[model samples]
Target chain A: MATTEVVVSILVSTLIGGIIIGYLSQRSRMCFVGGVRDYVLVKDTHLLKAPLAFLIGAVVVFAIASLVASMPTWPWFITKSLMPIPGAPLAANAAVPIYNHIILAIIGGLGIGIFAVFAGGCPLRQHVMASEGDKSSMLYLLGFYIAAVVFMAFILPNIQIF
Target chain B: MTEQKERKRIIKHSYLIIIAGLVTGLIAALLQITAGVGPPNAPVAYGICIACHGRDLINWIVNAIGGTNLGYGTLVAGVPVLTVVGIVAGAFISSTKNKEFKFRTTKNPGVSFVCGFAVMASALILGACPLRAVLRVAYGDAIAVVGFIAISVGVVISAAVIKVNARRAINREVT
Candidate 1:
């Protein structure tokens, strides 16, 4: 297909996929951080099951897809290095070392975990909540979208600290 | 509809999540197979992510309308992924249909904003949100596994902190 067609198809497929996931997410109040927090605090498996299910489902589907298609990086751990999949920073500059990627991942993980917990839901959950007319979640998304621009433009450039 | 039929129609949350996951995986893979969205341009597991896709979508719009060359994933250089938009629309439809949509307001707007800002910053650092982190791990990215462990550790700590705070509040009330 042509470029415009490819873009349109991607947009359509992703929109449909997102809508389905979002509908289910709103019904279930699915939150990954909430899942981990609930299980950690109370040993509750109700929400935890969603992330587990998602992992298993994605893994199984991806495995099936790999059989038919030639994905050079299907199993990234085997084909690529053990480094985390390159984020914007690493993606921009491939020369960043593996250890740096690990460090970044740890820092990022901790921050995401702590803040998401404090904010009351994961990003997806927040989005669902916002859609359900939660003002706080809407504010959260406002900050989220702004920060995305700030991070890409300013913060991402200065984060060379190893 | 009969109560029994309605009950049978209500799918379990686990099944819903599983279906979401499977569809997400299929979309990612199909994008690769049909549209060639991988490797050189897009990374593996580039299907669905709250943070990355939101960033790419917003920037794509900004660059298009404002004539600003804001950076975004090359995978979405042409057209922004509409997943985030769809999520909002879908959730709105679901909540409104179920009569669950309520205009709940918060006292501390700043707190929510800061939390969102920090979350996005960290997500960009980690390169994936929790959902995409799981996707990366599923695709066999070892470092993503480490990130996943760290996220779990953070959650444990947060849970402990919240527990302690709750206990403190209870103790204060008793006193």
Candidate 2:
């Protein structure tokens, strides 16, 4: 396939995937926190099933695609490279040293987890919720965008501890 | 007798939920592994991250500042925009079909906004959100595991807060 064709195909597939996933999530009323909370609060399990199903589906698709197409099977799509400082140790590949920085990783994870709970959803869940016409989720998404811009521009540069 | 039976059913359901969650995590991991390798003859991974593309945008910006190339920014931001737009469009269609479309908001807008900001900021700081984080781990990024553990700790803490608040609300109602 030509480069343009390849790009177009990928875009189309991604869109289809996102749409299908989003629709399914909405129909299922799947919220990650809600699922876990249901289990914790009252032992309800309906909401949790969708995410589990999603994960399974994703894995299966990935496996098939990897084997058939000779693609890398790891989740490189989701990995973001950390900007290494001058003194920071570099991994063999472009993998960020931050992956090895246990302390910062833990702190960052704690923040994400707590914030997700407070927001009543993770970032992905917020997207799903927004798609469902949840106004609160839209607000959350706005906040998320702002935060993303801010972190990338300002906060990330000063943190030497990580 | 009815209450006891209900409790037993609930317990059974909870087990199912746990199993489902574990399975989902594993599946997501598997997908991450497959997608990590770029598709045959393609420089880009088939399903590269929606958010990491944002980071790539930042990289482009930095490169631009350094008088380097800027062509890559479009690709970085483009995929996420398409994915999110697709998500919204899909939801709309589904809601239309199900007759579940409605504009709704919580009682407290301010709190919701704050929560949203917090969630996004935290996600940005970690370089990926929960979904991305898990995918990162699946792809063999050891750092993502730390982020996931931290996410669990955060969840527990927040859950405790919810519990306390619920208790207080119950006490107030009782009085």
Candidate 3:
């Protein structure tokens, strides 16, 4: 396939997948923040099932698919060690040092977990909220992209810690 | 009221909802793996991230509308996350279909944006969102376990804080 053809295929396939997932997400209101909150507050496991199932399903399917297909698979986690190799792309073939993983996990995870609650939803929930015309969610999304861009360009380079 | 009732029924049927969620998640993952739409299955699993993918979408929009690119590789890299766009659009369609599309306004926009900032920053730091964090664990990235633990701790702590604040508010009202 031509370069343009490859890009188009990737985008189209991804969009279709997103549409399928988002439609179901909207139908079910499957959200991690609400799920965790409910589980903590009321001992309810109902909402938690969505994320758990996604994890389980993704693990099983991806493992089996990769094995069966005999295609090369990247490491299970973010590969930071291979990145900054002088010519590697940011999105593809990037890696981080193993020592840094610990800090990133604890602090990063806690922050995302906490703020997702304050934001009133998970990432999936944010998309649904914006789609439903929630002004606050839209603002949150705006902040999301802006911060994402700035972080990737500026903050990510300077951070020696997690 | 009817729409609300219907939503309640759907939630109440936990088994059906779980099955549907599982199917959709599996299909999404399968398609992403096949399509090779992303770097790998780590911090970004295809186009699933809100913050990262959202940036991609926003940059495309901004550039299309006459913003100048500085010619840096990242600045000029044109990977528009149409999946994220499709996500919101699909959600809009579903919300409208079920009559659940409520236009929610916020009393505090500053805090709202702050929450977004916090989420994106932390997600970048962590190298993944909560969803991908769990998957990272399954993928055998042992480091993510600590992150997952922290996520649970954060949730439980927030719940306690919220409860305490609510009780305080109630006491003030009663007084």
Q: Which candidate is the best by lDDT?
A: 1
Task: Please list the residue runs of candidate 3 whose C-alpha ends up more than 4 Å from where it truly belongs after superposition.
Answer: A74-97, A160-162, B1-12, B38-44, B60-77
Per-candidate DockQ values are 0.65, 0.36, 0.51
- Cα deviation of A146, candidate 2, in Å: 1.1
Q: What is the lDDT of residue B113 in candidate 1?
A: 100
lDDT of 2 by residue, A55-142 (tens): 5545555556566765443444333443211111111123435445555557666877777787787666677677667888888777
Q: Per-residue lDDT of B46-134 in model 1, one digit per residue for the tens?
A: 67678988998888877788887766764543667788999999999999999999999899999999999999989888888998888
Query: Candidate 3 residues A46-161, lDDT tens each?
Result: 88898788778777777786777753444443443222111112223235555555655677778888888878888778888889889999998888877776765566566544
Query: Which tens-of-lDDT digit does each residue in A20-135 have in candidate 1?
Result: 88888887778888889988788977677767777776677667777876666777887876756665453456566787777878988998998999899899999999999999
Residue-level lDDT for A65 in candidate 3:
67
Could you tell me which 10 consecutive residues in candidate 3 chain B have the lowest summed lDDT?
B68-77
The TM-score values for the models, in the order shown, are 0.91, 0.70, 0.82
For every model in order, the TM-score on chain A comes to 0.92, 0.69, 0.79
User: Which of the two, 2 or 3, has more TM-score?
Assistant: 3
Q: Model 1: DockQ against the native? A: 0.65
